[model samples]
Target chain A: MKGLDLNITIVGLGLIGGSYALALKELQPKKLYAVDKDEEAIKVGEEMGIIDKGFISPEIPLKESDLIIICIYPKDIKDFVKNNIDNFKLGSVITDVTGIKREFAEEINAGLRKDIDFVFGHPMAGREFTGVKYASKEIFKGANYIITPTERNKEESIKLIEDIAIGLGCKNVEKVTVEKHDEIIGFTSQLPHVIAVSLVNSDNLGVDVGKFTGDSYRDLTRIARINTKLWTELFMGNRENLINQIEEFEKNITDVKTALINKDMKSLSEILSKASKKREEMS
Target chain B: MKGLDLNITIVGLGLIGGSYALALKELQPKKLYAVDKDEEAIKVGEEMGIIDKGFISPEIPLKESDLIIICIYPKDIKDFVKNNIDNFKLGSVITDVTGIKREFAEEINAGLRKDIDFVFGHPMAGREFTGVKYASKEIFKGANYIITPTERNKEESIKLIEDIAIGLGCKNVEKVTVEKHDEIIGFTSQLPHVIAVSLVNSDNLGVDVGKFTGDSYRDLTRIARINTKLWTELFMGNRENLINQIEEFEKNITDVKTALINKDMKSLSEILSKASKKREEMS
Candidate 1:
């Protein structure tokens, strides 16, 4: 259970995986290993000293590691786990850093070996850039970490994951039900991405819109440069909650449009003031 | 029309005005004067050496200044210019930093003194914080500056404003028709604010959503702490264009929602990819 004494393996060494490997290196684990289909990423991780060793497949690393951290697209999680379930060492703890939880947790736990435990987690931190070369452990500093443990999860496994999250410099480690996690994330994460993408795609200005943009426009659309295949998986996996969030946002946009069209300055002012107050409260 | 020798007067000593005053100090104008009904802002401006003198009324300052920069709300531009019509120095150049332009330009030009030229402008720079105390000229460094010169504007007046914009550290000085200015600002500036306000207002999550948010949500909602009164005027002043922009954005959002509802991963991925490519081009 000691963080520094355990052997750790990271599956999928991209931005998140590379960052986790870099951060976990600080814990001084006995042996830090990584599995990535992209051999270049694994080679870079080893060169950067982020991982002690690298593997193209999980068979050998999974059997020796005491903890396995999977950092891959949400759609690939089930297949990855199901295909490698037998390779995982008995009594080892497993966790993931995907955006969605409920269904993935249920599917994985349904067929998971009783001796191996999977503690679901999500670290609320990332950059617009991709790849292992862009990865840094600093992204985790002061970030929020969430754990969604199902009924079958053990306290010891949850505690182990929490300890690692804290060791990675997370500011808050909160536990929420899988349903609540998805619902809140729908509002806080998915909705913002949807809005950013929509804003960018709504570009009708023929001129270089970048020249006319201020800080607000720049910041709002910063994430619009998204990873297509990955986000498609996420948007579809958490379909219902994300749709509800988008609809709620659409309703708000309608309210503003109506007030503007009717020249109801009073109503528009109130809406803006309420939003301003709410944003201040968040700070 | 030497930059350092001219007498400059900044009307309405709020965030934009105060920042302009501070930036203009670098030019070391012969005299820097600011007028604001908020006498406290004027006093602070004078004490901080941002302005050489302060005035409660524009009458006296307007009579002597060679350059006047009006940084007031969009709705007040006409009234301010009307009230001070006879006071402006003969052949002196005047400009403004309001978000909207077309109507204000026409209305002010209708009864404006022929000798005093009013060159319309909009600085593509701002902060969520307000008032003279929060103002910093650094906001203009690398920011865009737009000039919407009407038919009545003299070439010399437009050149003077452009020079000052460069002196103030603006990265680009673009000239566009008043109508074009409004159209572009609707998409670049106003639409982002509308989205930020709407996103913050659509808070259905009962939980403290801050803990669950990542950089994307924080960046997207940062401007939700808006100046409600000022934005109300800007939103209404540029009503039609902003409405069109919002409708366009809504259509894009609906595209995303429809794709999600039908579980059309390919279409959704295409939409996201298009947005991502457009955003990358902007960068």
Candidate 2:
């Protein structure tokens, strides 16, 4: 497992990036470079021995092995890649850990050097907390990793990414189209977070509400403790699909509301019963 | 705690009622009666030693119980109390464990004999599964017991109910107006359930969708496994407040949607930030 001697540079030392640094260490990469805008993150990475080299900015020297993993936020991704593409040699494999893929795939392809292989992927794993402090390789255990490869992605690059995902302890590695990736993610991740934020802020709640909170309330709002800047950028980047999902969700709830208003027990019961059956199947 | 020799009749041997029987057993009531339309529940309650006596129907003799707890569903409650009001002797404190109280409080008060006392109360605790088979005294652990007492309720009756709540191991006992109870529950309980059911049924969800589920998706849809008939009745009873809450939730989400559509990052971030802060406080 440790035979590969490729140099790996992980950009951004946030949760996902830091986890990768720890997990990829098992593969015994020849040289691992950790780059982040935060000086404290680099110091921590160096002290923790997760990095052979640390850089505080993207503009630093980037001559290394041919694998580059970008874990920056959605808005900065294109600019970061465009400015740093020259850091890698020709025939380099570049992948990113962003929630939205279609726009990123398009924008990155438009600006990336022709010889580079850029495959947009998302690791379907996260914690309710953020930062390098909370990052751990255990989070990837039994989690799925998705690769949305464009026409330009070569088989060798896809294999390299999949190998790293498996080395990180992801349970499943599935390949999907960029469009399909966004749609599935819109329903599963973004829509749920939107519901949580809205549900938590749905009322002019008071401090005393904690006394009345039930298990259901706590469970529903567990994800409401969010990172505003990161999620806001992701939402805007995936705005079209997320909005469509919200509309679909609202329509479904409205159907329930109308049935409830009319005291149409049959309709209400049928909807709830179907939901229960489906939920049972899923769980 | 077991020194009291009060006679207690718990009507409706469902989850809440059965749990109450087990919990109140700690107080050592002289005679504990478990009443249910299901003979199986009564037999189980007796065999489990949670009840000294069991009644299959409300038509049976009620005798001279100092306290009566009705844990029946919302629709049949008024009829059950109205039909059995003559069973209890004068000055019996009748409290209910129904979720909704505004209409039932008025109806029960109007129908009860002048000497009878009715204090509408709610135990903010439940399980996804139902019936006496699932009941446990431990469900009351860390749960809040709320009493929505009307002006007709005597001070002694409220104290008796509060005693039973503490006896049941409820962490806190709170007093709320019927109006306030309905409103708060509309947001905390009913609206969240509605969201769960809708989310589970939002689309023609495929069986394979489970592969994409994250902790957030699972948390948000945990209550989607629901009892259709019981929830339908409860929702209809609290229709006005529940519908209002749905509207408010929709409005809140719509604000998020508008912000996302306009790419107004500042507004979106602020909304998510406030929600995160509030969620942090509650948690």
Candidate 3:
């Protein structure tokens, strides 16, 4: 402990947190602190030797930490920051693994003691499964990490957070304003899920879609089975931007509807051709 | 060709037609006639030895065929049958690998010579590639074949069409009325394609989506790159039912929009959970 530079603490040892611990373990931090409401998670982390020690509460020696990373649900993000930001040492950086960044980043910065640095980044990788047992550091190997930094953020703090994302093996580490982060993700991520759910609920298809699906139905609805509680929060958190995306999609579909009704083969064919070409270019 | 039992002519030797010839080749048909506008395709079929003879037009030997299978676009079905149905030998059956059924079946049956039969069936198999070069008999090995029989379809004629479908290596040969076929496909097949196209056209997704997409966007948009001409016809041929299906989807999305705006987690969670459960149940 005499001369070691980094003291890292990981809070909430679920899929993301435990994966972060496994990733940070390779860095060989002087001390790794593990905190979770679920005691079993901490026990598993310590048993796996991914943590130097485990804590069930935030009231411990958090001020000693150089960096603290949070990986809980979006709903829990603010209260945890409010309760624990004071316990962190002055000028030390804190970041998160939350997928959405806008409101959370704003709230965290506004609520924090200005001396304590809070930088927000979202590692865009996940699995269908959850919990510490299912976590693996390899999830970050080719994944994206987007940092949403406001003007209030210090350059050094942002740099420190970006360095951690890079060291965690993220392939793309970039910065965006909180507004851009929500809008881009609304179109690419949230809207796709919204569309899938809508398509799945379109009908109680009498035929077992499983036995008879061609590539279309099967591929489009593959994400239909989703985490409801988590997604509800995520969707509700970004509803306005998502609804805006949905409206744009509705406009596209309306064009198709008009073409189909008018039997305007030229227009329909053009739209489809453009979409097909765009999809190819995307690849 | 003297004293041979079976004489088969495949009209429009595209992917499905070429694959059919390869599969039928094993049966050692006394004659396998290939008709396509692209004489290059006919030569390829002849060179590949998948066809006994190639024709640049459907004009030759429609009367000699024991069975003639059409593999052209759905838009060509009505005219092709009107001009050539009388040429087929008495009591012979003609079929198609067309994707949709009801209206085509009605029009062909109404226009056909009473002595000859045009039995409408859809081979539920395909590849992204087109033309005889891309055809494979193996595409039908585990694929579903739906035989949509109209009231005009004679029992003997329907049986002959089913025999051909089964012989081509279909795993399931299910029968439904033309009405049922359109309705079922409206939800399972057409709706999904519409959703994918709409989502792809939602925004000019400027990011290299292939780089950052996880399961949701990648899996959902796999079918966004579709055959424009063919799908447009399919969508047009079955527009009313597809529009109905789209309305059902619109309703579902409206429900989601309501839930999101109201911050009604209970309602939002219910919708997601039910969709997930239904997807699992379908599987």
Candidate 4:
């Protein structure tokens, strides 16, 4: 299907869904639609001209959409797919924007309609702010997009998703296995959130430490103002991989602490320099 | 001791020193002088009009200046003070911009010339990039300035430093004992660097994890491209307090890890919510 001729529908009009609607508008789909539980979100999205139409019920939009992007909570995805199994258009492409992918991919692939193409995707972009009101197309600009494709997916479906990711201003589109996706996301996405939360929680100073903070503290904890319910679900969903990543991080912290206890400046300097060199290579 | 009539000399023209010179220029000091072992740094400061004169030796400027700001490595501050003890003009105010303050304050207070007043101050601002070339006066704008005073410090000298801190555009000028300053800094400054370095070093995915990163990972590790030599000195000089802070942080990480391992969503949600609340309160 040609990108410009397809009808696209976004489910859940929160930050990610709303942002997808705004960004996908650039493709000028034949019709852009959104199905959100919140009437305010749908009204706002339509009023903002991000979507051509909005629906509180998914049955109508799902039947017409050539491409459907699911942007709800991870735990609710299975039910959304199961409940709407009969509503989806025949031969339509389905994608998701969830952080964890392994279990969802397995469950959805096994139970999904054989005529539908479910290509799992994760757009690695977000803001600390939540809701449709804060959504912007600019979040995906120069961001990474990951495609975790299963054997059930077709070549054309993956290509269609990659093309859309690029159209949304992604700088890189890399393919990985569902397992690889979960493990890497455990480190790159989930671990950073864990660390930021822990760092903020560890503050024991009676006085407001904010007055004494520099760029280091502020930058490090910028994401500590988190979405609690969503992140808890993300954390529990990928528990094993996240636990391993947390252990590795804790061991590294122990190494630094041991060096500090021994007053071993040589080991300390080596560790810091290695991290510095590695970080420099990243950019 | 009036601001307009006083001559100010900045010792050791690195990032902090160069920035002080640039910001202090707004006060239009009778003469702004800089002394540094790096002749090129002094030359650049003078050529950029951040300072009126550059000195390879501290003797001339130290003898004439009424207020002297020392900005050098933490380990070298003692030696610089000892060597330049006689060069300081009688009753001139002296200050420093080091991260750790307890040990330096004690040693300097016990051995300082009775006439010269040493008021220990730490400007809570820095960039990941180092040296005079990257220096800008804007770093201190709305930044925190901390003054840690001992019994040896004169009230007038502390007041003068506060005035300069405000003149340099610091949002807050806070006073604390040396012990309190070091303890709070260990939590606010050193612990964040330790966590950043550890987070970068903990990357075991083997693949280029950078491609998968979002704002959370990038923001948390921005300081991982650290000034190794200087930070090593800082981490070691404040070893005890830093170790305590690290242990506290490790405990919090363990709590999250345990919650994940147990699949206790209630505990996980509460932890994340508390952190979110605390972080929201910070801003």
State the C-alpha lDDT per candidate: 0.91, 0.85, 0.80, 0.92
- The TM-scores of all predictions, comma-separated, are 0.97, 0.87, 0.81, 0.97
Error of 2 at A82 (Å): 2.8
What TM-score should be assigned to candidate 3? Answer: 0.81
Instruction: For candidate 2, write residues A88-110 as lDDT tens digits.
Output: 76687888889888877898899
Question: Would you give the TM-score of chain B in model 4?
Answer: 0.97
Docking quality tier of model 3:
acceptable
Ranked candidates, highest DockQ first: 1, 4, 2, 3
Model 3 is docked with a DockQ of: 0.47
Q: Show the lowest summed lDDT stretch of 10 residues, model 3 chain B.
A: B205-214
Query: Model 2's DockQ?
Result: 0.58
Model 2: per-residue Cα lDDT over B1-283, one tens digit each: 5666778888899888999998988888888887888899999899888989898865443666878888888878888888887888668888888888888788778888888888888888888888998999998988888899899888988998888788888888889899888888888888999999999888543426677766788889989999888888889889999999999999989999999889899999999999999889883
Cα lDDT tens digits, model 3, A163-264, are: 777777877776877888888888877888888888888876577666556667766776777778888889988989887888898888888888888888
For model 3, how does the per-residue alpha-carbon lDDT over B15-88 read when each residue is reduced to its tens digit?
88999999888767788898887889999999988998999867665767888888889878788878776567
Model 4: which docking level applies?
A: high
Could you give the DockQ of candidate 4? 0.84
Record all residue pairs in model 3 with backbone atoms less than 3 Å apart, i.e. clashing: none
- Give the C-alpha miss distance for residue B93 in model 2, angstroms: 3.7
- DockQ of all predictions against the true structure, Cα-based: 0.85, 0.58, 0.47, 0.84
